[model samples]
Each structure stands twice: as structure tokens, then as C-alpha cells.
Target: MRPLEVWLYGAGLVLSFVAIVSLTRSIVVTIAKRKIVEERKAVQQEVQKKNEELVKQSALVESEYFVEREAREKLGLGREGESVVLLSPSATEPGIAAPVPEAVQETKSNFRLWWELFF
Candidate 1:
């Protein structure tokens, strides 16, 4: 009778140990999955923000104002018969300094400027 009772107690102990280990493993997997989901959400938000910025940039690029601005800045172009006055960097300061004047021909194209710069 004593031996039979000992066997029953040992079996019970082993079963409880298995149950605890299985529960712990399940908890660990749940935590890992939660972390992965959070990371995925963060990445998605960043991608959405980048997409919004690209949309805004594309819209700006397609606008007529953007084309005019680019032409004027890069090609040194202006409205017909309008004199484009250029001021030297030093002239903008508050100090009194006589700024030398240099005139660019209105007919000179951007290609001519590039040619002069390189050759």
C-alpha cells in the first residue's frame, strides 16, 4: 500500500511540472509576437510619412510656379525688357562698400555661360 501511494505522488508531481513548463513557453511566444506586431506598426507609420512627403514633392514639381522658378534661377532668365539686377554678396551687408557693377548680356543663354565656365 505504501509503495502504491508513493508512485501516485510522483506521477502527480511530474504532471504539474509539465503543465507549468508548457504554460511558460506559451507566455514567451505571446510576448515575442506582441513585440513583432509593435515593430511592424512603427515601420508602417514611417513608410506612410515618407509617402506623404513624396506626394507633396511631386505636386510641387508639377506646378507652373516651380517651372518658372527653376528657369529663372538656373537659366538667369527674366520677363522681356525687364532688367535683372544682380547684387554682390558683400553689398547686402550694412557696412559701406562700393559694389562694382558687372553687366551680363540679356541674350546670353545658359549654354553660353556653361561653355565660358568650362572652356
Candidate 2:
């Protein structure tokens, strides 16, 4: 074969090899960028959910019922002629029950009551 033909063939092979490497590199980069985008979307969704939960709790805290309940329970306070009563733990026995206290009779939200029991 002529020297020029051999050199031309070698150059063509090298250029094709370079093209293939560049294509594979770009594909890898594109896949990595897609994964990063998905992760960011997941994180944004989580943040949005947490923000909604905070708004719900803020509304609850602002309610009159929550304020009155907190004042009565935490501060041991009442309106005029509304006496607070205390009872012994033994009086609360289920088998031979005594009168349930006023504070205990005041119903709590199921979630709040469960949270208090568990946490």
C-alpha cells in the first residue's frame, strides 16, 4: 500500500475514536444532570409539604379553644364561680371508679392526646 493511503487510514481511525469518546462523555454527563434535577425536585416537594403543615399548626395555635384550654390546664385558672378540683390518683381506678375530674372530662383532640401519651 502507498504511504499516503496508510497515513490517511490511521488518521481516520484516530478521529473516529475521538468522536466516539466525546459522544459517550456527553451521554454520561446528561444522565448525571438528570439525576441531580430529580433529587432537587424531591427536596422541593418535601419542603412544600412541611410548609403546609406549619401553616395548619399556626392556625390551630391562634384559635380561641386552644388558648382557653391552655389557660385552664396550664395556668389552673377559671371564670367566676368556676372552681377547679383536684383528685387523688387512686380515685381514677377503672374497676371501682370515682367521679372523673372536670379537667379530664374536657376532651382533647385525638392526635394531641396520642402525642401526649407516646411522647
Candidate 3:
């Protein structure tokens, strides 16, 4: 073959190699970018959920029922029409069935209650 033809073939081979390497690198970078975007979206969703939970807790803390319950339970104070009852430890003996406390009666959402009933 002529020297010019050999040099042209060599240059074509090198160009093809470079193109393949460039394409492979681009694919890897694109995949990594997509993964990063997905991770960021997941983290943002988690943060939004936490913010919603905080808002719910804030609302509950600000409610009158929560405040009154806390005051009555913690401070041993009651409203004018209410009377407080205290039971001694000995009154809750092994044979006697104790009354269920108010705190134990959790207020469940209707959805949760139905789910629990069905499931």
C-alpha cells in the first residue's frame, strides 16, 4: 500500500477509538446524573413528609384539648365542674381489674381503625 493510504487508515482507527471512548464516557456520566437526580427527589420527598409531620404536631400542641389534658395530667388541676380522683397503688391489687387509663385510649383515624378492623 502507499504511505498516504497507511497513514489515513491509522488516523481513521484512532478517530474511531476516540469516538467510542467519548460515547462510553458520555453514557456513564448521563447514568450518574440520572441517579443523582433520583436521589435528590427522594430526599426532597422525605423532607416534605417530615415538614408535614411537624405541622401536624404543631397543630396538636396548639389545640385546647391537648393543653387541658396536659395541664390536668401534669399539674393535677381540673376545671370548675370536674373532680379529680386519685387511687392508691394498693387499690390496684393483683385480683382487681384496673380501669383503663385515658391515655391508653388512643384516638385512631377512621382509615386506620377500619384497616385494623379488616386486617
lDDT of each: 0.91, 0.92, 0.93
Per-residue lDDT of model 1, residues 19-119, tens digit only: 99999999999999999999999999999999999999999999999988887888878878988777667777887697556786478899998999999
lDDT of 3 by residue, 35-71 (tens): 9999999999999999999999999999999999999
Candidate 3, pairs of clashing residues: none
Model 2, 3-117: lDDT tens digits are 9999999999999999999999999999999999999999999999999999999999999989988988888888789999865787777687775658656778999999999
User: The CA-based lDDT of model 1 is what?
Assistant: 0.91
Q: Candidate 3, which segments miss by more than 4 Å at Cα?
A: 80-83, 92-119
| Least well predicted 10-residue stretch by lDDT in candidate 3 | 96-105
TM-score of each: 0.60, 0.63, 0.64
Q: Which segments of candidate 2 are over 4 A away from where they belong?
A: 91-119
Which residue window of length 10 is worst by lDDT in model 1? 98-107
lDDT of 1 at 101: 60
By TM-score: ranked, best first: 3, 2, 1
